[model samples]
Target: MDTIDREEVDEVCALAEAGQQDYDARFELSRMLLEPIEDEASDSKMIACCKGCDHCCHLRIEAYEFELDSIHAYYLRELNSEQQAKIKEAIVERYPIVKDLGDQEQRSINVRCPFLIDSQCSIYPVRPMSCAGYNSCDDSLCKRSNDDPNDTSFGIPQDQNIGYMKMRQMALVQMALDLSFEEEREIISGMHRRLFG
Candidate 1:
């Protein structure tokens, strides 16, 4: 629940503006800004999300354009042909299933992320801001929701400070690049479009 300082926000915005041409730098800056908050949460054991937990990965993920650019770049640059082919196949298969559905309906179904390989994120380092911001404090709630799509009775606890900072940073980045928050797109469809079209 800590508030981000104005100076920090201004600095990030200025840096983002200056580095407008570099999506990698923008994405790294966004991640750098959140590292401290993530560390604190981890130190306090406030996060229930752990390795091998892919519940959230099954949910819908939406990302800003620059974020998607970073991910796409990473996918091409870091992964080998085999890895890339597997992810492409997953995206192609999953996109048709979720494309026509609304966000709520997408979340209601357990559609796996293309990046999820063996219950782990293949592109963990360059995950979207929304994915980075999500910090579930109760794995059981996540499990419940994942297990029963109808069980929306409880909400997962997250660090609001992290969420707030992520939004602020992304907004500033978008402004710097002359982009709109409205340009955000669902990750799977976005990736599929990028990969195929």
Candidate 2:
């Protein structure tokens, strides 16, 4: 796995500081920080995730406030009224059940992501780090997990640097927290707040 260099981390921190109020800069920084994880996943042959493979899309999609802001921008600027209405409908259907639940509970809700269209992420380019971080070598495990929420078979290999990715996520969250950004929120609630608030 490629270790993120200290210099890179510092650069990301600088970007986060400067871009706290700049949505595009913050979004770009998020993607840059995530590049190493993607590279490592590719190196390990564990990055089998692709469009139309929407198993993980059913899992809770968590996002930082800035990331949610990016998605909301895409939602307003890109989606047609009908598309937006359909997503809002999905949220209306599922948000009630998952809204008060904790993060882990939200993940087990088994609802397709509101932004999933024809089994592809409608906001792929600006997807949150949480969504971007989830990579699995085994498609079967993804299927099983999607089929049975209780099944523990769904897992990415340890060699994929999940721990490293998680640590990087925490660092980013801490940076955001220091800047008074909301820690994180599940996709449905986050989007609802972004769209309606």
Candidate 3:
């Protein structure tokens, strides 16, 4: 994971609000953010993402137990020891209600992963594969001025692969495959509450 640009969230918020909680749009925005990049080009092409835009941060990116552990590892290194403690504290205090998820839900999606700071994710780096491969390319309801001649998000990119719009993607699968059963089990239970708050 990489550092996010703080400015791009405004575009995401406005468009998301207009979508009126459209799950598809929310999912798409969250998916695109799994890929954090600084050189994807700023063109209006179907695949070209905006620079430093982090609307995805505002969206929920559920994580499995392994992902939560991965983020814990990351914060230990990327953030100060105290910061890591804070994240863990946050998790311990309030992990959302894990719903009746499917079989694979533990692999990539569950309880919002116990890591979020005021709707902003603090562990971008080491954010887990689940956090890296999410994206959506639908264009029927973009918030940018559609009539503007400079806009690049017109029709969806024809050449772009369908993989660009998928969730619980490959990276997530691979990461889950790599976790230990103990780690995986703790994720499903509230036993690891001390790790994140």
Candidate 4:
């Protein structure tokens, strides 16, 4: 993984702390920071992820509260009432199956994310930073991992720079939200609470 630049992180954090940027701006900043890195990685022709690949969506996803809030807002603003209802129903049904699962079980199971519709992410534009940061260089390896839970090889190739930059951007967001890392929660449960409660 690439080393995080302390100066870059500090600058973002300072802007966040100054109360100059809202959630949208913060997320946009994250996108701006990641764009060049993703472009460089893509030029290598090693990125295997594509629009119809939802294998990774089955994995457990954790995100900060602010990230979840951003998704929720997007769902409410961009989707119609029927679409919202369907996703909420899916979350309600899936939550019980996943709510009590241990971390390992959650990771091993293939529960589709509530936002996944017809094998595509319905909230792609506002996907969490964790999702934004994830990349794979081998679609076959990803399929193997997703197809068989016992396949614990985790041998998928990834761009370390993308992951490291995402971590730093997340730190900047945390500082902006005045939240600790511990505030992060499982995505399904977070959405369940947001939609139902």
Specify the highest-lDDT model's number.
1
Which model scores highest in TM-score? 1
Please report, as a residue range, the 10-residue window in candidate 3 with the lowest summed lDDT.
35-44
Task: List model 2 lDDT by residue over 1-197, tens digit each.
Answer: 34446676577677767676676676677667566556665666445676689888888777777667778877877789988899999888877877898867765657788999888888777777777777777777778888888766446444447547756665655653453224677889888877667
Clash tally, candidates in order: 0, 0, 14, 0
Q: What is the lDDT for 14 in model 1?
A: 67
Pairs with steric clashes in candidate 1: none
> What's the CA error at residue 97 for candidate 4, in Å?
0.9
TM-score of each: 0.81, 0.78, 0.40, 0.80
lDDT of 3 by residue, 36-151 (tens): 32123222255433334343332334454534544444555467766666666655553443334443443233233444554455665446443354333543322232223234
Query: Over the full model, what C-alpha lDDT does candidate 4 score relative to the true structure?
Result: 0.74
lDDT of 2: 0.72
Q: Write the per-residue lDDT of candidate 4 for residues 119-176, one digit (tens) a residue.
A: 8888776677778778898988888988997787678799777777677666665554
Query: Candidate 3 — which residues are off by over 4 angstroms?
Result: 1-44, 47-68, 99-113, 118-120, 138-197
Query: Candidate 2: where are CA atoms >4 Å away?
Result: 1-23, 153-159, 169-182
TM-score winner, 2 or 4: 4
Candidate 1 TM-score, C-alpha based: 0.81
Question: How do these models rank on TM-score, best leading?
Answer: 1, 4, 2, 3
Candidate 2 has its poorest 10 consecutive residues by lDDT at 173-182
Off by over 4 Å in 1: 1-30, 33-37, 178-180
| Residues 60-154 of candidate 1: C-alpha lDDT, one tens digit per residue | 89887666777887898788898898999999889899888888888888788999988988888778767777778788888888888778788
